[model samples]
Each structure stands twice: as C-alpha cells, then as structure tokens.
Target: MERGLTNRKEVAKLAGVSEATVSRVLNGIGPMKETTRERVLQAARQLNYELNAVASSFARGRSGNLGVVLPHVPKVHLFSTYYFSELLGGIGEAVHAKGYGLLLLFRDPSEAYDYVSLYRTQRVDACIILGSSAIDTERDAVHRLAEERLPYCVMDQRFDHPQLNIVAADHEQGSYEAVKHLIDKGCRHIGFLNGSPQYSNSGDRLTGYRRALSEAGIPWDEAAVYEGNYSRTSGKKAAALVYRDLERLDGIFVGNDRMAIGLMQGLRELGCRLPEDLKVVAYDNSDAASFTEPPLTTVKVPFYDMGKLAAERLLRVLADKASDPCPQIKEKLPTELVIRKSSGN
Candidate 1:
C-alpha cells in the first residue's frame, strides 16, 4: 500500500504474471506483449507500486530524464513568449505521458556549452534543443553532439548532418500561401518585413516571398524589403523605413505576429487606414494576432505539435539504441492560413 512496503511479488501475484514481467513493464526494458503489459500496469496502478528510480537507473544505465536546452538572454522573459511557451507545454505533456523527468537548462549564446556532456554525465538519457540560431558556437555544439552519436533532436532548426534529427514547420510553403492570399486580394506593390537571416525559417520566408512575386509577374523591389528582428519595435521601425514609399505600397507581408501588430500600430500613428490603404498578412498566428485592432491574417505554425513530435522522436531513438540503431529522422509539418480582417478578406 505504501511506497517502501509494496513489492514486485505482490504485483506479479495480482496480475498473474512472473516477477520478471513486472520488472520489465515497470522499467520499460525488454519487449512486452500488449495484453500482458496492460495487465501488469493496471495491477501496479491498483496497488500503488512505485519503482525505485535510482535502482532502476543503475540497472538500465540511464538517468530516466530528458534534457531541454534553451537560450539564456539577459533582460528577456522566456516563458512569456508565445512561441516558447507553446513549445514547452507540448514537451511537458509528452514527457509526463512517458513517465520521464525533464531537466531544463539555459546557456548563454556567447559562452560555450557541450550538449554531449549531458548524456556522458548520466544527467539525461536524451536531449532536445530549442530556439537554435546560426551562431558559430551553437552550430559547433550541435556538430559535436551529432559526431558523438548522442540521442537528441533540434526543434524548428535544420542542419546538413545526415544523422541529426529535426522537427520544423514548412515555412516556405506557409509564406508562399500568405503572400498569394494578399495577391489574390488584388494587392500589388506588396512590401515585406522579414526577420533576421540567422534563423533558417527567416531565409525560407524570404525565398517564398520572392517566389510568390515572381509567379505573379511582379517585379521585386529591393527598396520595399525591410529587415526586422521579429519584435514589435522592429516592426515599428520597418514602417518608418517604408513610409516614404507608403503611397505606392498596397499590401505587406510580415515575418511574425509581433511585428505585424507593431506595424499596425506604426501605420495608425502615421495616419494610415487598415485594409483600405495597406492590407497585411503575417506568420505564427500568435494569440495577440487575433486581438489586434483588425485581427491579422497569418500563417499558423504548429509549434506545440512540433515539440511533441520532437520529444516522441527522441524517446524512440533512446529505445532503439537498446537493440538496433535507428536512422536519423527529419519531419516537416504543414501550416494553415488563418484569414482575418487585417487582410481585408
């Protein structure tokens, strides 16, 4: 009935299975049959049997923990961001369902951190890296982890390594659809406010934007493209840079919802009308996008789903290592176009 008092013998007796079966089911080691595994698990639940994590880890040579790495930035709130919060929520759900512990760590971009050390130190059985950039030091760390053949995954980032696991959204297609929607609205001379090139998604969005223009027989104007930092302030700054040619600009495609909202605010202050003067579309379908003055039409990226998939893929990798090696997997999820009043639709 109690933690220390309940033993495997009683569990096996209740489930009508051998003690070894109970051990296998509890430790998640060895192959298991469906009906037998369920019976053992149910008996354990009914008896409130708790396995000794330390003993099991010693036997399995694992920590039974998953590592989640995030970037540490001064003066920045991590959880408040819509993107990271959704991602964490999804990862937490998957980790809980698998009955594994989560170890969250943050490292400064300017400093050095060895990702493979987590596995070597027995702190985590696997790792998931989030919010990756094209920084040289970060790329080096990823390469080191891959070279060591560690079980890990990177969310929303892609590397050229054949063995690296990646889960990301199809940003290029999403961007193309958003731009096409704007073009369908008879909006010509569309301006673009894009994020920094450090992230691959930013580059993909740029490619999609150019492709859409080329398909529609519109000339690409270098002066109409403004680079933003995926922030509201940057969006406001982008508005000023395009203001001199605002008269000729009929629509705009922003990189993210935060920037889209800021661009709206900037346009309002600059004596511009919504949808009537300048139609707008953005990406990331964040919560604030819906509550804007005229709800923004944006690309809805499945961050939560991608996080869950990444965690699931990492768990599979850890399991496969016990028997045979698993091949590297790269999954690209699709996005949806959420039309709202901001795009005049």
Candidate 2:
C-alpha cells in the first residue's frame, strides 16, 4: 500500500460507493449510512490515503475556509495597538485550532467594495469583521451576506444589522467608570479628549464621559472638549491646543491609550505634573499605557476574549448548530480599571 496511491475514485471503487460518498465520509460530511461510512474509512486506512483539501472542499461544495475582514490593519501599527492585536490574536488562534483555514482581508472604505463583489460569489463558508470601519462602507456586502444566508459576526462594533451577531466590550459603561474614578479622586475640572464623532464607539465613550460628569453634578463644559483622530500624534496636538488655549484644567480623559500617552508626554514637556497639576485617564488600557513615564490609569477591555467569542459564534452558525435565522446576539464583555501612577491611585 503506497502512500498517495489512493485517490477518491480509487477509494470509491474499492469501497463499492460513489466518489461523492467517499468524499463526504473523508471530509466529515453526514447523511451516509454507518456501514458505507465505515467501509470508506476502512478503505482509507488500508490505503494510507490522505484527503486533498482543495479537491475535497470542491466535492463538498465548500471552500473549507473562513474570511476575515479587518479595516486598514497595516496602515496603522495594529500589533502595537493593543485592542486590534488582541482581537486578531484571539481570532487567529480560534480559527487555526478548528482545523480550518483563515483568509485575511484588509482594506479601507474605498477598497472595501471588492469584498461586496466577493460576497456575491459566495466564495467563503463564513466571515467575521474585525471592526466597524469596514462595515461603514461595505454595508451592502453585509446585506448581501445576510441575503445569501452566509454566516458572519461583527467583532468590536455594533451595527444595526438584523442578521449579524456582535461581540464587543461595554464601552459606554467602561468610559463612565473611568470618568467617575477620576472624579472620585478629587478631579473637578475634567477635560475630555475624543476621537472622530462619526464612529459608534467614539459616541458611546463620549456619552459615558458626559453621563459620569452629570451624575457627579459637574457642569459639562464644551470648551474643555477637544476632538482628535484616534492617533498618537492627534493626541499630542490636542494636548498642545488644550494647554496653550484652555486654562484651569485639573483632569483629562483621553479616548484611547495611545492618545493618552501622547498627551502625557506633551504635558510633561510643558512642566505639567501628573496627578498634581493635572490628573489623567484614558481608554483601551494598551501595553503602552503601562510603559508610560508614569504608568497610565485606563480601562482595560477584554479584546482577546471578544475575538474568541466572535470566532466561536461564527463557527457555531456555520456548522448549523444555531437554529435561529438572522439571530441577533449582542455580547457585552466587561472592562477593568487598571490603577497606576497616572491617576495617583
């Protein structure tokens, strides 16, 4: 019995079954009789046969692969960006462990139209989108996936798609808690540095910051709010603008950890003492937060857990374990407040 000598046709001939039946048995597809399946398996073992992934998938009418759409991965330092890397790592681990292949697609809004065209072809068995950036432009692709009954899930953003499943952190509550913590630490004149207001996460985080201040009877000062672009440089520039323009700011809440680090460095250059002259708090508790001159106080989101859960849910849907059509699953994972020197906590 020579290895690689037994192809599907040979196995079928030996087992006295059709090539399709042999294919189904080898690839774990069901509906074949027990005796027929055992006969095919026994033949395979005797022949030392290995299934060709491409051929077997073709026979089964599937690609045996999953598609992952992440918006602009390499454009930014995603690995250094904690939230993106953790989510991607979790997704990669879960998919690889399941013995299926993963196809990563990274594109900006303009280039995302190609994915929409691909969805029309029904190429992949299922898909998982990493962030909302892709969805903002490729909404039609998402709609097409739903129309085709293809399984998919959103990782970190909440879109109002009736069919899509979502796994995300509790950004609203986390931001609220972060702001409240600063307030409890005797920060009265708190400033909010935000990212783009178009994204749902940015809006949710802003709402949380506002809600926390309102609850604590602190007046919402529009002058203290500065908008950035979710970049470290943006944070540095915003800090300069705030320091040079605004006066009497006792605390600052940055939208993300990268921005917070930039702001902190900027403040230090301007002779602003941490937790003494101005307290600082940020979101996304990235690794950079811990390495800042004074370790940052921020909200630590379970990004990896979110990725794992999203992958698992998508697999369940693809495997036909989920019976509900167009199931709307909203999973809200918890976030923790990591205390360090930044907030003087």
Candidate 3:
C-alpha cells in the first residue's frame, strides 16, 4: 500500500509504465494500449491519487475545460426557457465525450463581466458568451479577455470582434419565412410581438417581418408592433395590448415561444379563437410550444446544434488553431418553420 500524495510517478511505478505514459493516459492524449491504460487508472484509483488538473493543463498548454457565461437564470422559468439549458446540454454532452469539463457561469451583465475578469486571472482555457446584446454591453470585458488572448466563442449572437468566433441561427430568414407562412394562409393584418428593440435579434426579426409584409404587398403598420420582455408574463401583457386593437389585427408573429404561449393564453381569455379567429407564429420551438392549446406554429432554432458548434469553435481557438480554415468559421444555421394548428396552416 503506497502512502502520502499519490503523484503520477508513483502511479506509473505501480502500473509498470513510464511517467510519460501515465501523463498521456490521464490527459487522454497519445494512444496507450487498453490494458496499460486500465492498469494505470486502477493504480491511481487504489492509491486515491488525484491528478493536479491545473498543473496537468499547464503542462499540456491547455485547460481541459470550457467556461460558459449566460444571462441570469429566472427562478420560476428554469426549464421552460430552453435557450440556456438546451445550449448547456449540447455543450455538456459534446465536451464530455471529448474528455473535457464545462464550467457554467450564470450572471447578469455586471457579475458576468466580473466573472470574465476572474476567469482571465485564473486558468480557463476558453469561454463562450451567450447573448448578442449582453455581449455588446460587456465589450470592455470582452476586450479584457481579448487582451489575455483567451479563446472564446459567441453563441446565439453576432459581433464585430475580430478574434471572437460566433455561431448563430439565421433569425431574419426564419422570421421572414414564419410571417410569410401566415400571409400565405390569408392573414393580412399581422402584428409583431417583439423582445427589446435594442437587441440584434429584435432588429433582425423586425426587418424580416417588414420584408415579408412588403413582399406580400401587405402594408406594414408600425402601430401593430408591441415590444415586451422575453417572458410569458410579458408576452401575455403585450398580447393584451394588441388585443385592445383586435379589430385591426388578424395574425401575430411572436419573438420567442414562451411569449407566444402567453400571447395565446391572453387571446383565449379575451374570447379570441386561435387559428379560426386569429393566427400566431413564434420562434424558438421550445418544449412548451409543442404542448400549447393549439400546438404552436414556430420557427425552430437549432439550439443543440448551435451549442455543439460553439464548443467545437472554442476548442479550435484554444488549440491555437484559429488560423485553421475550420476554426475561423462563422455558421448561421437555418431555422425550420414547424407548421402546427396555431397558424391555421
């Protein structure tokens, strides 16, 4: 029985392998025979040896972990809002399979910038910024990370940062297609339920909505646009406002699914029949969208794919392969417009 700190050398000695071999096996690098790998692992376990993650990472010139920063999580709507969770799930699965760890950091813009500062001082190999608006507001933090030369990727957002990689859904195209679907279904007076106008997504979606209306020869009415926070409560409130002018609106395109669900509920309470009296379309085909009274017609953002893409991009940057044609990539995955009962299609 070995005593004291069980370092890699001691484990290698017990496993009858060189210290370098132990390093390779532990770090998941060079191919050691299965038998040899297993023996080294068992010896480390028996000796209660824990590899120094930081030291190992430094030696390899990489940290086997990725840091993800997201907006503050709402207490009531944890799983209902699938944006962060779906992205995190995809990132977790992908990185775990690749023998890496994921450190999820949830904070508002202020705290998020602080975390980025602390991360720079520490040993994180790379990071992913979640939302475009939040990223833009935290540009100073982003610049700090840039100065440190930490590999980072932006998810679900676009920015003009030269060094930051980005993976996002084509929101403009998706919104255009969604509104177009409603127009094709004989809806003329369509309204838009939008998130903050300050966001890039809101601006792009607004553009899409206008484009669709213009192409359909339907006059765009600015009065029909109702701005709301991205939440079911806000959606419901926005819908009530739209309902006040119900005589002027026959359809709606909501920014996200949760708000869409709230809109539907509001309309129903106001005695408006869905699809029959008013049609609705939304973005982010979250789980709740599918179970709505009349299954929601939505544009499905490929959240899982986006997360995986972000992780892969970050890994490439961390590996100092930014110049690799593969890492310098920006992908705008297409969104699918899932037709359901809500849009009367």
Candidate topping lDDT: 1
lDDT (10s digit) by residue, model 3, range 55-112: 3433444445688877664575554468878988888877877667787676675443
Q: Could you arrange the candidates by TM-score from highest to lowest?
A: 1, 2, 3
**All candidates' lDDT scores?**
0.83, 0.75, 0.76
TM-score of 2: 0.80
Cα displacement (angstroms), candidate 1, residue 183, comes to 0.6
User: How much is the lDDT of residue 11 in candidate 3?
Assistant: 87
* Candidate 2 wrongly placed segments (more than 4 Å): 1-60, 73-75, 111-123, 134-136, 321-326
Worst 10 residues of 3 by lDDT: 318-327
lDDT-superior candidate, 2 or 3: 3
How close is every model to the real structure, measured as TM-score?
Answer: 0.84, 0.80, 0.80
- The predictions' CA RMSDs to the true structure, in order, are 7.1, 6.8, 7.2
- lDDT string for model 1 (226-337, tens) is 8998878898888777677788899999999988888889888998889888999999998998899899999999999988888888877765535224457689999999
Clashes of each: 0, 0, 0
TM-score of candidate 1 to 2 decimals: 0.84
The collision pairs in model 2 are none
